[model samples]
Target: MKVRTEMYNMFDGAKDYLPVGQTTLPKLYLILFLIYSGFLALWAYICNQQRKNVDKIHLVMGVLLLLLTLKIICALEDKRYIRNTGTPHGWDVAFYIFSFFKGVTLFTVIILIGTGWSFLKPYLQEREKVVLMFVIPLQVLENIASVIIGETGPATKGWFRWNEIFLIIDVICCCTVIFPIAWSIRSLAEASKTDGKVAKNVEKLTIFKQFYIVVIVYLYFTRVVVSIIGAKVNYRYEWVAVAAAEGANLVFYSFIFLNFQPVDKNPYLVLHELEEDSAASAHMWEENISLG
Candidate 1:
């Protein structure tokens, strides 16, 4: 019970240092809720606009988005219990349960998003392919981190060390995803300068892409550096730093993933002009022109 009290004090100390006028997990939860909700709405809109039927991937993502929302709620409950009981160890088993759910929810989301992006290769340019390849590994790393988190327990003696390892992997993934995308977007922007309308769409998309990438990177570094400092300073607010680090991911992914969809390939676009001309001449004067 004494350890529990100390843990509550730990939470209080962390909460005190949160963005002045804000509670720690609750604030983060509210923001995440809004972000995910917006994403769900956007996905629905995209689904409606799709010319063909919604595929299994879209259906899966829709389901995952809902589960992630539930995870936010569970995280809020954990935060509340910790705040009230001051026990970060485990509260009647809810701790492990919540951690497991959060891990699974996030892991599923990251994998699905990455998989969906890869499916978009038909529509992606060569530079996009490079950026995507770099992103895929990072996303896999993040998923592995989540799996590790789910396997470890808060009260386990070596849990913190394992968690730290997961965090390191997470940071690596976030950095890889960010810098590669940023560079690719910059390249696309520069190349598209002479093309007008298409260029404008690319530029607009690039802006948000760059913004989210930078935001993810900034938050990742901020959380990582603060955690290192917190560990060194023996600060009572170390959990706060951890929360901040995790929060960065929650926000960035929720925001950016909404705009991602599985791109369809245009078979016609792959044909050369010469092939098109030949096909046209071959079809000339024919009642029904069909390519075999």
Candidate 2:
């Protein structure tokens, strides 16, 4: 049996166009670019029509989608360069740059959403801020390892070290993302008993549980299942593994946007703030307490 690929002419003075095991990348990336663009546009429309309901968290989601779209375009261009010249000399830098920002923004959105920030409340806990502080630096190192791994191939002495570092950091980040979700579920369960909003808390608990499950499934598929597939597959079928990973990503991002997109809500339920007169009275009480 023979698999036909787009091989360059022998007289063209190039060894190969697309790299081995990556023949499908251009088409895959192009399609993803279009799909991501559609998501970005749809999210933008939803936000525009519901302008009064928009919040900082909605802006973060939009940024995540925009980053993903730009990242895919960079990937497409890089693949095109690879297709024509057998190298990603110039375009891979852009891809990695977007890749870094995308990773950071993605984790920010994930952690914030997991804790119900700007949806259930307007503030983050100190511990949550600590998570963000660490994640940004970790993302930087992850992308650095990725670029090094890609540029050095498997031949360099430190290639194995970088690969291990990349995997460890990735697994850490994946694990980190789920804890906040778990915390939210537990908090909702406990709050239902104490907050005098049992029904509301129960509804949110169900949503949080569903979100936790989605995150676990998404991470397992992308990290564990995809790795197994790539490891077991023939080198020639690497494209299949890549496609599976990207497809999972597309689905994951789409689900996040759909599940959590902004909509009009009762201000009291969403913000947890007192009515204006009550708020003013509370402020006076606080001031009197402080003065006493």
Candidate 3:
């Protein structure tokens, strides 16, 4: 009886030193995200195996999904630690690194969808490529700044100022790619005639436009709404919302992958190849049956 009472007193004392917050919701969302990511990875593997030629887009998307899954896991684990100890140590840096890569992969996915590789190469410029290359590096710098600020003052609370700055930069970068892609699709849809091939192209672009719009909305929810709420309320709750948002985003990407597998069958790729083949055949026939 004496030992049990002493142990209980010690446990009570330990609780007084622990951080305060509920972890159940964050944990639940993390589990869901993990399961979703696992399924997506399996689907991507199957997609690659079924294809006559391996699809780079699908492979890349799969890898990105896995990376994002790792990011979420690291983030939640870090949060869990913070909740228990009132401070983050190692997992904090791991979370930031995964976050950096996830952002880069997301940008790559957007580029792949906006411009089918061979046909749309002419539309993209060297400068745009350079800009894309810099996004991850800039994000890395931002993370470093955030960490330095966070550790120097009230730990995570010190990041409030940097968070807002980073949010603005993120919005700008997302807009640069998203708005132009939306505009280009709209232009294509308007220019397309009501013929079979052209109509098919328009249909595909319409779907792409819808997907892009949803993505923009999701971005707004994550970057704007969550940021605002986190600033006003507890950051832990904000993480719960973020986990849910990320899970939904994963679903969106999965839908995109399922609907647009094999890349070659995509209407844009099909039409472009058809036109190129027709032109080649026409030139060959003219050469063979020349009329002088």
Shift in Å, residue 270, candidate 2: 8.1
lDDT of 1 by residue, 1-292 (tens): 1112323124435532232222355667667767767777877787778737455656666766766666665556555555555543443245344445454444444433332333323244565456556655555555555555554567867767767776776666555445434554555566444333342335344554655555666655665575675567434444566566656665665554444453343221123445545545544524244432
Candidate 2 per-residue lDDT, tens place, 60-81, comes to: 9999899989999998988777
In model 1, the runs with Cα more than 4 Å from the true position are 1-64, 77-164, 179-183, 186-190, 193-209, 212-222, 225-292
lDDT tens digits, residue span 1-292, model 3: 0001111124455422122323454476478667757776676777666676445666777777787778777777766565555555587778778877877788777766665432334445564466566665666665665556544544556566776676666766677667446655765676554333454456557766776777777777777776576567674354555555666676676666666566445653345666745655665666679763
TM-score, prediction 3: 0.69
Number of the candidate with higher TM-score, 1 or 2: 2
Candidate number achieving the greatest TM-score relative to the actual structure: 2
**Two-way lDDT contest, 1 vs 2, winner:** 2
Candidate 3, superposed: residue stretches over 4 Å from native: 1-19, 83-89, 118-127, 145-161, 194-196, 231-240, 263-292
Question: What would you estimate as the lDDT of candidate 2?
Answer: 0.81
How many clashes in each candidate? 1, 0, 0
